[model samples]
Target: MAAEQQAPSILGFPHRPEWGAAAHRRAVAGYLRRCRDHARIGARQAARCIGTSESTLSRLETGLAPLKPVEVERLLDVYGVRDPAERQRITLLVAEATQPESWHPYAHAAPNSLRPLLAMEPAARRIISYEPQLVPGWLQTEEYAQIVIRATHPTLPAKEIDERVRLRRARIDMLRRRVDPPVLLAVMDSEVFRRQVGTPGVMYRQITYLLTLLEDLRYQLRLHIAPLSVGAAGAIGHPIVHLRFFAPEYLPDMVYLEQYEGAVYREKPSESERYLAVLNHLCGVATPADQTASLLRQALDTWR
Candidate 1:
């Protein structure tokens, strides 16, 4: 008699409808790594089984290389993934990973480093952001974003500038209108209010917009102002965003550190924890969320 068939093991890849290509790639990479670990196979052995170099497999696992559906199937076989359901989910992830994201059109305007952050933003369950010099991008008003972009890229063509602004607006609308939007905890230095971006009217309007959003209960936004008196909360003079996803069982938290020219993505728990620690420190030093509205009103008075 034939041996009895075993029930398929469920490998939980992100099944969300809102997941973009980047998210799918992330899921695929994570799933592959986990599957290999479960099978107790070393990278060299697995790569040999799949007829690929260990370095090539390393790139696939790190999401630096595209994962084709055929390659996924071969890797699954090598990793002893016998469950059909698991295989199907992986196939779907591979398909999704190859698809274009909403920002694909404006890819020319966005730096390659920034693309991953844009892709991951929609999938985040909660976002903790600390901006030392400017308002967080997710919270910036259209006018404010335009002025900041123009100032940063003085030589950028007018048309490209417009495209970048539109991309920013689109991102804001998408996040704002989500059925289950990510909770946003944003900490900005008090110096951000003092550092003028555009005209006085622009600053006033931006502050008013921020106040309105702070009062609105629908957005799930918590705004904090790190007072000048705090005097260096140990967050370096850059922006840090730590994104937490809904599926902690399979997905790991990510930290995005934005530099002057590019950005870095921290996915390992050890690396992400350090940034999370810095964010926690900033949160502790910043004024409480309840007092944020009053601080904004005071800043508004300065513009007035």
Candidate 2:
């Protein structure tokens, strides 16, 4: 009897090299990494084939390094990727990655660790983002974000702080485009309102915004507040995000965990399953969607 084929080690995604027109930068970066792993080539070998250093190759695989079209071509050639459709898809990803971000200077303010997530957002079919600390970045208003920026980076220059705030604010629009946007189900800690951020005014406005969004007739957003009763029973202390692609075989779901110095992306099936289970538990314990708006209103009244 033949043994079952083991999943690819890199992205843990099913293989379909002949997929079409994948323009998402994150998807491309992931695809490239998987191809290299599928070919069983070491970083040194890839660097030699692509005329770059091992460190550079590592960064490219992690989506940290800026990728040029020619570089993608070189890497693909060395990885033995001969599929015409896959080549075109990767080439399109190169174009998308090289395009200028419209948010300009603000967009440039975010660190490399975060850039990949933003790139992935456009391509994600569904997103499950959890925050135990405070409001999720995408849902935060400018005033609330300003307070967060100051508190997080107390020593940052005023100009720089403003830039960071604008950058975060820009993230909201990234998900609001009328075109095909990913469905976001943000599960947050119940302490969000109870926890003081900047001032009562800021907290009030932010809560008000949350209330509005929950009531918004037009969004695929599912805002769930995990009640304080659940407490430590929830997932780990840190934040977690799981991103699923439209084409399941094209790129496996990725779990993103952010730390102080950097972030972690888990593509392995086992790791992703654990995170997904935690999120499901949190969702189960969280207030029902119908009651989320009411809870926000109660919190909003306290601010008033």
Candidate 3:
């Protein structure tokens, strides 16, 4: 009888099981780029050493393409990576990068532009969000989400809308249930409360939910209201989500900007830091967290 084939071992190198596939891919790409630079190898030289085109190497380094195990080994060899433990760890990263993300099932309902953000949210250590028009998706109640979805995508069928709502709910539940949930600091313009999404009832329920989350000690959430009273403040005037990961992951901070048709992602430190600055300004100018509940109550009164 033929002997059973065994999978190759990772030599006991630990991989971050909590990170999603997107995070792993970015880490692998960043590590490969750093290794090549550290070895004083140009892109052309590295590509030639690996017997591939520079464009392919560029894609792999940018996280646009996955690196095969053989390719990883060859790159390590070329980069003079002699440390056995480092090799094992990178090999494990490549393996994990190829795995499916939890958001894969919602791919059909989610826009291609938004999938990357979905995959990265779970792996983030801190999420700083700013909303000028409406409540952020992570804090939206079901009724509020449904109304927002329908208004935003009037052409989408009810079934598709329901799927989107479910996706948002899943994200909220994941954060709530996570043992070490990311620290969420959300800043919302007071106009969000005055916008009146669905109905007075919906707005009331949603604000109540926000208050409940703010009061819950178990959640690492901080809410701030950018009061309309703070007129002409230095605000970004659009929605922004800045996600920061732990250092051990080797992942860079990412900024997500949503537009009407598509979204834009800023990964460069300079670009992301600009957005971070705007968010920081908003946070600084906004009502303090302790006073947020009062603003919420004022809105509740207005809705009432």
Which structure among the candidates has the greatest lDDT?
Answer: 3
TM-score of each: 0.89, 0.78, 0.89
Candidate 2 lDDT at 205 equals: 92
Considering summed lDDT, which 10 consecutive residues are worst modelled in model 2? 14-23
lDDT of 1 by residue, 1-304 (tens): 2322332243655566575677778778877887787777899998887678999989888777788888888878877787777878877778888888757879877778888888888778888999989988877788999999999889999889888887876766545654777788899999899999899998999999898777774467898899878876734788999988866655688999999889989989999888888898889988999999988999999999
Candidate 3 lDDT over residue span 51-90, tens digit each: 8899999999988887788888898888888887788788
Candidate 2 has an lDDT of: 0.74
Indicate whether candidate 2 or candidate 3 has the larger TM-score: 3
Counting only residues 3 or more apart in sequence or on different chains, how many pairs clash (N, Cα, C under 3 Å) in candidate 1? Answer: 0
> Model 2, 3: alpha-carbon shift in Å?
14
Per-candidate count of clashing residue pairs (backbone under 3 Å): 0, 0, 0
Q: C-alpha displacement of 60 in model 3, angstroms?
A: 0.8
**Where does candidate 1 have its weakest 10-residue lDDT segment?**
1-10
- Judged by lDDT against the true structure, how good is candidate 3? 0.82
lDDT score, candidate 1, position 39: 76
**Which parts of model 2 are misplaced by more than 4 Å?**
1-26, 29-47, 53-64, 74-86, 101-104, 260-262
Worst 10 residues of 3 by lDDT: 1-10
Residue 169 lDDT in model 3? Answer: 75
Name the better of 1 and 3 by lDDT: 3
